[model samples]
Target chain A: MSECTKLEMKDLLPDLARGALAGPALAALEDHLATCASCRAELELVRAAQTVLGATPSVDTARIAAAVGRSSSIRRDATVAVAQARRRRAWSVAAPSRRVWLAAASIVAAVGVSVIASNTTRSPVEPGPAPTVAQVEQPSTPGPTTPEPTRPAAPRSTGRAELVMAGGVSDLADADLESLLRVLDDVDTELDVEPAVLLPVLEGDV
Target chain B: MTEPTRDGEPSDAALIARWRGGDERAATILVERHAPAVSRFVASMGERGEVEEVVQDTFVRAFGSLDRFREASSLRTWLFSIARNLCRDRARANRRAPTVVAIDETHLLSSSDPLSAAVATETESRLRAAMERLTETQRAVFTLRVAEGWSYREIADVVETTEGAARVHYHNAVRLVKEYLDE
Candidate 1:
């Protein structure tokens, strides 16, 4: 391809087309182009390529600019959104929803109402402490469940009747009357007989 | 040979500095100045139908790693280097043979010289076809050197070769184009 002796001069063809060659370089390229048809034709080819580039479709600068800018904003927005979501999660964990609080409150109120209703409606079934015979002796009203307790047919002559003579104490439950009479009678009879004999029976029950 | 625009606008370094300082308009100006040249280089490298996308990706990657870029270097050549890498990566991803896409005149968007557009489209197509016949490296060297008016050093940097290799590629490319056109 070096028909003209100066093949190295062909390298400057690009600069010549771009008008970058100046002073000595420009002078030299011109001096060599005077006799170099190979270099001249190559220069034409380079110029033609430059022309094609100029005429080719160009990308829309505005679109690319907007894309770059959007990346920054998108990152910022994503960060903010994540932070807000975390805050909401923490708040929900710290304080439960109002609906949950209301449901809990309703359960407590229902339990309290049931407890008070049971305490008032039923006899105070808290295990009645062992009543002293004196507390049970008051011939008070009939028992709640029986309405009228038949006089416990055991000894009316026994000193247990004297238990009734003993002053009536307050807050005596009529429910304990029958048992109280029978137990007091038995104890009186036992004391009269022998504590030695009752001990064996009580020990057997234990 | 690299310089500011004729109207005394800001240089690439100045724009990059402003962008780093959060003045976003500077980024727009930089894209406007360099995207056309990057597009031309990408198209000349046998990338068709995706020229704009490749150009866009090059800028995005360049700006993404702007902190690492040396401001003193030529941004245009740097963009060409990035575009070259992107085209290579895409070729590998596709795992298909490279095909030369013919340049369509109807796709022409803007031109500096209306007279050149009117008179030179057919010759331009012929030249583009001849360019497409060269090896990928030769076409890239030729494009950066002749079309973008880049020096052999800048071309070597883009194509990842020595300046001597770039010069040889350019010479071979010219000879091949001449042969093709003569046919």
Candidate 2:
């Protein structure tokens, strides 16, 4: 037999024993192996191995599923543990700052308490008598009893526009202002519509 | 709550979205659905003591990195990948310890008579011993193929090897296992 044929025969021997060969190929391989004792022994060994392997119990799907469930739980706990560890690390880093803030707040509070205590320990100062309203109404007293100095101006008539513009204001462009007023008027008119018809129209708009 | 979607069952994608939106039920559903697969994978790899804990860690890691998981493979496959890595880490950590045969007691009882089962267990123990004798890569290739029934291509993808190399490993593994068994 040719070298290529020998090689093909060796590969085919396993297939033949496994019943994987078919048609003319099976016939040719059978004819070659009939006279080949070495090939026959190899085929027997391959067959035995296949049988042994085939007899291996099919892994239990339920068991697999159970294992998968266990795996998921383990993974979840690990993640939670890792997250907890990170939180612990972060809290550790923040602890000194928290103490510093507490110290600062305590210092401020202590100073405040000391100031209040000092103020309370001292004697209270007496005040002069309060001024009468009639004394305050006198505009040109020029003495200790006189009211604080004032800049006096003559009263003038205030128009509606002047009162409206008293607060610093923008004069909008006429067309834009008119459109805004028209929108507001439309909104008012729409609000006056009956509830029944307004509902569908509002729904449609939405 | 809104009515169930037209498909009867909400898709995983929908469930994922709901979980992301803070639906606790969705999170629970996801956990209940996929946790067993991870557990079985770790168990098959001979993990014990804290198998459930490992499974939980795998899920939490998967959830935290759910954003990075670009649906390139099925969700199960993705989870398996995560689980496999976790198993590897656990295996490395325990390399110095004496290996323990942690076969399920019930599985051992249900497997034929006590004598035959004991012998089978011995054989399995031998097989495991032989497995230990092989390099980690060889054991991984052999287990993923023989135990998990992965195709060579699938093995290559999981093990990050060329397809041709995977085939060679499979052949090598078969030969080694047979030799070990015969002994």
Q: Which candidate leads the pack in lDDT?
A: 1
TM-score of every candidate? 0.60, 0.44
Tens digits of per-residue lDDT, candidate 2, A108-169, equal 54444434433332314523333322232334557665332220133422333232322111
Q: Give the residue spans of candidate 2 off by over 4 A.
A: A1-206, B1-18, B21-33, B96-106, B109-112
Give the candidate number with the greatest DockQ: 1
* Chain B only: TM-score of model 2: 0.74
RMSD of each: 25.1, 19.7
Each model's DockQ score? 0.21, 0.09
Docking class of 2: incorrect
Which whole-number lDDT from 0 to 100 does residue A201 have in model 2?
A: 22
Model 1 error, position A199 (Å) = 89
**Candidate 1 lDDT tens digits, B1-183:** 364464778888888889878888998999888888788778777777888888888887777667668766778777888889898888776657656655666654346888876556667677777887888898888888787777788888888889899988988888898889889
DockQ, candidate no. 2: 0.09
